[model samples]
Target: MAKLTIVASIKVKSDQVDFVKSQLENLVPITREEAGCVQYDLHQDNENPAHFLFFEIWESRELWQDHTNNDHIKAYQAATEGMVEEFVLHELTHIA
Candidate 1:
C-alpha cells in the first residue's frame, strides 16, 4: 500500500501555546508505539507562535484511522478542545 500522510494545521489561543505544546509532546510516545505509524512530528511556526503543524505518515489508511480512535488521541482532542482557534486536517497520498 502507498504511504498515507496527514497534515494538520492548528491555530492555538495565545496563552495556550505552551500547554498545547506540552500535550503534543505526550503524543510522541503514543504515536511511536502505534503499529503502523511511520512518522509523527509536531512543529511550531518560528514567526507565528500560535501556529502549529502536525506531520504524520502512516503505513495505511486503516492505521491512520486507528490513530484517530486511539485513547490517547481522544484525550488529546478533548484536552485541546477550547484552546484551539482553528484546526484543519488534510489527508494525502504519497506520489513518490
Candidate 2:
C-alpha cells in the first residue's frame, strides 16, 4: 500500500487562537513518535492567526486510523472542544 497523506485545517475562534495553538503544538512530539508516522508537521497561517494546518504522512491508512484512536488525540479533542470554528480533513494517496 502507498503512503497516506493527511491535510488537516483548523480554524479557531479569534479569541481562542493562542489557547488552541498551544494545544495543537502539544500534539506534535507525541504524534511523531507514533508507529507509521513519516512526517507530522503543523503550520499557522501568517495572515490569519486563527488558521492552522497539519501536514502528515503515514505509512498506511490502517496506521493512521490507529493514530486517530490514540489517547492523546482524544485528549486533544476534549481540550479543544468548542474552541474551533471550522475543521477540515483530507486524506490522499500519493500517486506518481
Candidate 3:
C-alpha cells in the first residue's frame, strides 16, 4: 500500500498566536515517536505568525487514523479550543 501524506493548515486567533504555537510545538516530539510516523514537521508562515502548517507522512491511512484518535491529539484539541480560527487537512497520494 502507498504511504499516506497529510497536509494540515491552521490559523490561530491573532491574540493567541504565541500560545497556539507553543501548544503545536509540544505535539511534535510526542507525535514523532508514534507508530507509522515516517515524518512529522511543523512550519509557521514567515509573514503571518498566526498561520501554521503540518506536513506528515505515515505508513498507512489506518495508522494515521489511529494517530488522530490518540490521547495527545485529543489533548491538543482541548487545549487549543476556541483559539483556532481555521483548520484544514488533506490526505494525499504520492503519485510519483
Q: For this target, which candidate reaches the highest lDDT against the unseen true structure?
A: 2
Candidate 3 runs further than 4 Å off: none
- My TM-score estimates for the predictions, one after another, are 0.95, 0.98, 0.98
TM-score of 3: 0.98
Q: What does candidate 3's lDDT look like per residue over 9-79, in tens digits?
A: 99999999999999999999999999999999999999999999999999999999999999989999999
lDDT of 2: 0.97
Per-residue lDDT for 1-96 in model 2, tens only?
A: 889999999999999999999999999999999999999999999999999999999999999999999999999999999999999999999998
Backbone clash count, each prediction separately: 0, 0, 0
Question: Which regions of candidate 1 fall more than 4 Å away from where they truly are?
Answer: none
Displacement of residue 39 (Cα, Å) in model 3 is 0.4
Overlapping backbone residue pairs in candidate 2 total 0
- Model 2: colliding residue pairs: none
lDDT per residue as tens, model 1, 8-70? 999999999999999988999889889999999989999998899999999999989988999
